[model samples]
Target: MRTVGVEEELLLVDAESGRPLSVAARTLQYAAEAAEPAEDAGDASIAASGEFAPDEVPGGSIEHELQQQQIETDTVPHTDMAALGEGVRAWRDQAITAARRAGARVIASGTSPLPVEAAIVGKPRYLQMVEHFGLTTTEQLTGACHVHVSVESDDEGVGVIDRIRGWLPVLLALSANSPFWQGEDTKYASFRSQAIMRWPTAGPTERFDTAESYHSLVSAMIASGVIFDKGMIYFDARLSHHYPTVEIRVADVCADAADTVLIAALCRGLVDTAAAEWRAGEEPLALSVAMLRVMSWQAGRFGIEGNLIDPQTLAARPAREIVADLVDHIRPALRENGDEELVERQIAQILERGNGAMRQRTMLEKTGQLSDVVADLATATAGLEG
Candidate 1:
């Protein structure tokens, strides 16, 4: 039992337009209540008056982000799987209530439904990002499911990330949610994946042997003026500076919280398995980054419709087969973590209907409308809440 945390970046959506709302007024409104702002706070998004569970107690300290259309919710560090679930649920439920009060809905999509004008968070740091990344990072209106798992040290974080490279696609396949973009079928499971990957440094990562080596590389990036800070080294997997954890940043925003929990559980299992193996003097098997990219691209392009490259053998395998195999592979860790049943149930769901991307695509295609997509995503979100 150690610290694991989640950072769910949610989209601020407009009720009427069904598009992203560039309303930091409301974003900050909810943030203020979550954090309990200055004396001028009685105007909008008051905290729901009640006693939060011990798991949700720390979520009261909310902060703003660099995008006007987004809010970042950090779940309290959890020592147990159940505690993590409770904390994530509490933060999301509180977010939903606050959004309702503001007459806006907190939508969970990687990209907005409509083409929105790019706007920063109205903060100086964000302005610096715009200036630094130019169009690549500035125009990114996307979201991700970032998971942080406990690690021994900075070196352990990178160690986990190194071993985690092969498993990143399995996680991405589970969390795919971006099926439609700008109100059209983009023919990709997670179009947001490609959009977000446009940044200078974001994709399936390579193994960095030690924390010192990782820091040296990042330091070089900073010293060369390629990135503004350590924060801008946005790889698919890396050591989290904010916490002592290996942060995996590949998965898209899962439409269902069950999928979110599934991804988190799987993530937890993967890191634990690798760390344990490493402690036994096992070096992580290295896979080709080129093949990894292709596998990820296939996942994004076809979602559950096509096969993915098995990173180990570099063979194309059906997505369904991959899921069953991955679930079986992580069985030991799942049991050790006391999440066997939860992981199995989640696996059954993926087998039954496919991931969120598949379901959302079917929903949209049947109705021949974009509204159906939005409604389906919201419905999935609501079901997760329940």
Candidate 2:
């Protein structure tokens, strides 16, 4: 089985007011301290307050983001879905505890519901990005859930990327969580997807038939002075710089742990299916980049609440139908990995309860307040509220 991992970027909000808080540095510091053995009484108190015991899962890390109002949590790659779910929950709990120590609450919302003056982190790379990108960097406080699935070789990875392009919008629709942005209902399910497209390099890419073509394109983009480095090659799906895996970067950071895991499982299935197809000498769908962008826009605009572009037919269809098509396309791989039952169950739950966007809007309808939405997100993020 190919190991899969998840990285979620989460918002830090004031526990009472639900406003975004610039305390990521402090929160990360507390997390680091909690991971180390206590050297003194104060250190012991800090470690004790973390509330979570370290797990045997390796490669898990907590890191600061470009903006001080968010932190990112990474799960170690795992071949088992149950173990992967545990790692996600454990890391989320650890982040919550550390954020509490820093006078903030961790939230799983993709964007803050209330107005926020996002503070840029003081790291040299971040500062340089701010200087180069200006408002694009400052205004980008969006969070996303990225899933990495291991592949045997870069050629296979690129082939998988080429074949998986058409179905990515379905993943985005299922994971759409950012409904409101800067105190207003944006009338879109995933405003974060819209916001991130501001980056020049962020969006769909044309098919790269080989590993050589993929690397050459990335190097050309960087050399053109549009982006700073390979890290900025923000294609919806790309080969990972640090791992022998293909990273799918289209989904929002889901508020529910189950939904996050479901996305990861689906991503792994997609990669595996694509790789198998490539090995069988199948040609990828010749979808144009423009059409893929349109499909992605439709998914972001309505999420599962409206029609989505079908990958097979290239026509508008109900979101449920498209999602079903996605499942059927990857069913074989999912069964091989023992994730068929889990994926089906979770997908049904999401469709019925609605994605995070629907849940957030429901909270607003109940309380008529965005702060309450944030509060509910925090509760859901900590796995306290269903």
Candidate 3:
């Protein structure tokens, strides 16, 4: 079995006001202290031990994001969903405790509902991004859930990515959690997707059946001077540069831990299904980047409320039907991985209770206040805080 891991970027908000707070640095200091066994152990202990301070965590698991308003947690890769879920929940609670100490709270929101005054992290690379990308880098306050599933080889990884590009939008729709931006309802389920697409290289990618072709395109992009390096490839899904895995980066940071796990299970299933198809000499679908872009836009706009472009025919279909088709297509892989029941249960729950976007809108409608939206977000995140 290919072990899978997840990385979630979360927003730090005021505990009372639900407004975003720029306290990531302070919260991180607290987290580092909490991670250490002794209070006075300090940087030396962290440096000398050279490992995550506790067993349930992993080194480099928690870190600062581009903005001081955001913090990120990464899980140690695992084959069992139970262990992965527990690890993620542990880190989330650690973040919540760390933030609470700083008079802030961590919320798993795709974007802040109130006005965003992004505080860019002071680093050379970030500064370069600010200079190179201008407002696109400065105004970014979006959070995403990235799932990394191990692959045996780069060729297999590229093949999986090539075969799975069309299905990426469905994942995006399932994880749509950002409905409000700048204190107003953007009316789109995932405004964050639209916000992040400002990047020149961010979106669905064309086919790259071989590792050489993928690397060649990445080199070409870098050589063009349009982007700084391979990190900026920003494809919706791509081979991880630092890990022997395929990284799926299309979904928003889910509000619930269960939703995050569900996304991970589905991504692993997608990769496994793709790899099996490749091994059987099945050719990848010839979907155009233009059409895929359209599908992504629709997913972001409607989220599961309206129609979606079915990947098989590129024709519009009910979002539920499309999702059902996806579930059926990946059923064998899910069953093989022993995640079919869990994934189906979570999907049904999502359908019944609604995704983060729908839930946010419901809160806003009931209270007619954005603060209520933030408060509800805090409550939702609190379920996994322990």
What is the per-residue lDDT of model 2 for residues 1-386, given as tens digits with 9 covering 90 to 100? 99998999999999889999999989988887777554432212223232334342224777778899998888778899998888888888889989999999998988999999959999899999998999999999998999999999999999999999999999999999998989999999999999999998888889999999999999999999988899898899999887889999999999999899999999999999999999999999989999999999999999999999987779999999999999999999999999999999999999898999999999999999999999999989999963
What is the Å distance of residue 25 in model 2 from its true position?
A: 1.0
Report lDDT per candidate.
Answer: 0.72, 0.90, 0.87
For model 2 the local lDDT of residue 170 reads: 95
Runs in model 2 lying further than 4 Å from the true structure: 36-58
Task: Tell me each candidate's TM-score.
Answer: 0.90, 0.94, 0.94
lDDT of the structure predicted as candidate 2: 0.90
C-alpha lDDT of candidate 3 relative to the true structure = 0.87
Please give the range of 10 consecutive residues that has the lowest summed lDDT in model 2: 41-50
Ranked by TM-score from best down, the candidates are 2, 3, 1
Number of backbone collisions per candidate: 0, 0, 0
lDDT of 1 by residue, 191-265 (tens): 888998877777876667888889988898889977778888788888876667788888887777777788888
Superposed Cα deviation of residue 193, candidate 1 (Å): 1.2
